[model samples]
Target chain A: MAFVVGMLIKTAAVPIVVAVVVTWLLHRLERLKPHAATLGVACGFIAGWFFQEFSVWFPVRYLDWFPAAALILALLPRVSPITAAWLLVPAFPKMVPPRLWAVGLLTVSTYGLAWFLNKATDKIQQRVIVGVFMATGTACSLVLLQSFSLKFAQIAGLLTASLTAALLSANKPYGNAKGLPFLFIGLMCNLMFIGYANTSSDVPTWCFALPLVAPLVLLWNPGSKKLQAVRYALVVTILMVAVIPALLVHPPWEAEH
Target chain B: MSRNILIICAMALLLTGCNSEEATNPSPDAGDNTTPETSSGSGFAVTSENTKVLFVGTKKSGDSQAGGFKEVSGTIGVDGDKITSVNVVIQVDSLFSDQDKLTGHLKNEDFFSVKEFPELTFASSKVEGSGEVTITGELNMHGQTGEISFPATVSVTDGNVKLDAKFKVDRTKFGMNYTGQPDNPINAEVDIEILVNAE
Candidate 1:
């Protein structure tokens, strides 16, 4: 009974969290309905899973060509809306992670961020710079996990900092490998953050504020006191209960095992 | 670089040769009385349109395990309605499962020890029973050879031969001990269900 209750709670929480994120993003886009936003998020998840399952019995597990295919098909202006909706399910499976989902997510996210930043600054050089930072960060994190904190810091600092400094001094080479380190670092950071989030029993209210407040401050700078109060109260309420790093605990038995 | 390439090529050739028949009749001793009659209709021939082999069994540690050889090429022959030969060529690297971690581990040293012993072949010394057959054979796995007896149902349906067999073998008998307790055996009783179709 307790196990059932726990499972039900988890199932409910995933959609709720996804919905919350979607709602927040859509709030900035005028005339976008909440239902449409929810649907989009759901579709993306389904598409991820579909592509992920395709790896099974499909010899090449690493080459996930579905995401790019979906993006291209989506861009076809003459494509029917219903066709797009049907394509969304297979696309949804692609978003779900297989065993190495965390690694892939970090790598892709790093590369994506670098590309975005490159576009924004009109400087291809930033790609290498970002890549160096990410790789160094991952290596440092891994080393830290291996040893005492002080030793980790000393070794990581000496090795990673020097490597990054050298790469930067080279004025950012236009190599494909530049983005790799950043992806590694990003993955480590995400894993560590999840670990910390789950382990800390008493999460300060400021924790919730970081994800929500940082973007709002950067983009909107709202002056309404009422909205500010609500945000603070919400954060406080969230902080009151421990934010157990949800990713830390996996089921004792593997579903397929 | 050339050395590495040469080594890899040699290994690939070695794996290829392993799939080929080693001997029509190979005995440990030069002077042996056992003569396996090949021409006397003494082999169980399995036929299938799709020649894929699948295995579902519990690991020695009682973990529900399933994997299959993507490239399993074999011929099972019967002598007088009994199985006398089982030549199975299971690609060690081709063993697959939905579970990625388990699949990788199975290919590692703890389980299949695929690098060391890439193929499993069971050649029977004796065959008994009628419709329900009991085959006493030498089951070679992980380079450690052991004698095993198991029951099988052999039949011909619609011009195609089907072989279904189930047997339990102690992995320990072949030096595959990974985990378990002395007081309460954690080492699993490995159950094998093999269905083969001759091409």
Candidate 2:
């Protein structure tokens, strides 16, 4: 009971509070509006601490570094040149697992998606952007909890929670979440990459790839508020109708009674 | 504002602790990654089939669960009638519990974290006594090293050696900090049984 409570406080309660506070503070400071979208990333960073890492932050333990990297990389972009963020790129994937060089592509993909999503979704619906990430996050956490490391699942959960709280707290609508896409992609990629690399369960390789393609559900936009619900319904439908059955192919380990 | 800054800094520090070893680029097979020293005559290879390394963890609910490692490899060296040195390596991934789910959970970060550490090793520094013997050495697990001394029974016959020992290792000592559920807390001390047959 205490363990569950502590986890709730650390991963859920603390992160929600931090996200709300950071988003609120940044919203109040007129000059800081451009920095508000980065709120979720920062909240995730603070939450990372309460959830102590599996091992000490040994150089190899960068598996737990996704949240921290998102905030740090997005820090200067709100105030300075975007190119400055590139310097932090080399830090991730000293070795994500299995292959040394190929995992670097995963790192590259994170930055690439961040740039693409930022540009593509700038004018898109806020409901669409947050919805896509939240849906993908839900699937990632579920898969990770069932098949991969639980910490990775919890990591995914906090990323989604912090981002949701921060994005919604900002008073301004779509414009408030500056650099939102970068933090979203980095944090998501971190957990998914960790899940894919280290999962000892029987989940098929293709099933793990499902979350990456989840964002594509947004492509079929109805362009109306009433139809915004379609995006989530489709994602859940694909995950449930397709994913859950596949995941069930290899039932997760269950506790003994 | 300064207080907020302090809170943030403290959180960051917790993630990246102080006094961390340099990215020393240590070899993949670094810590205690050697067989018994060859300088002390011939080394006895551990008969993989004859060796056993098992552990028993008890929960507060009085439901005691048992598990063991499947792959245990080591060498026992002997000089005359006395055992000179011992090196044992346990592959964490090979750990199996009573239930399949428990096996998977044991491999997660809450337990062995096989992906991160992979192996538990013990290399003896000193061996004392003949019939009722004691071994002292460093036990490395979860990236932390602690010296341990345990009593054992050893018999070196010709070129073969048979060893058996039962000891309790505090899991917390190795940084395995999971306390189980509050209602059914697991004991911190876990029973470890070791049996090695070398011929």
Tell me which residue pairs clash in candidate 2. A1-B182, A37-A177
lDDT tens per residue, model 2, A1-257: 24543663466666666776777777778887766657654665556545554534433445434444655656743221122222222222133433423334444566556656666565666656776777777777777766635576667777777766644753433557777766777656655656655656766766666676666566555777678677668767766643685457546433342
| Tens-digit lDDT track of model 2 for B1-199 | 3563455345434533544333221222533446746576678876458799989998887878899999877788888888878888887778887776678768876677666667788889998999679999989887678899899999888867889999999989987877756577889999889888778
> What digit string (tens of lDDT, one per residue) describes model 1 on residues A1-257?
23323322333343334433543454455554312232233333223323321222322212122233223322321221112222221111112332233333333343334334323222334333433343434333332322112212222222232233223222333222222222222222333333222221122323322221111111222358786556445533432322222111222244423
Against the native complex, each candidate's DockQ, computed on alpha carbons, is 0.04, 0.18
The total number of steric clashes, by the backbone 3 Å criterion, in model 2 comes to 2
Query: TM per model?
Result: 0.35, 0.81
Residue A33 displacement (Å), model 2:
1.0
The reply for model 1, stretches above 4 Å from the true place, is: A1-257, B1-37, B42-53, B57-63, B79-84, B157-159, B180-186
| Model 1's DockQ score | 0.04
Error of 2 at B162 (Å): 2.0
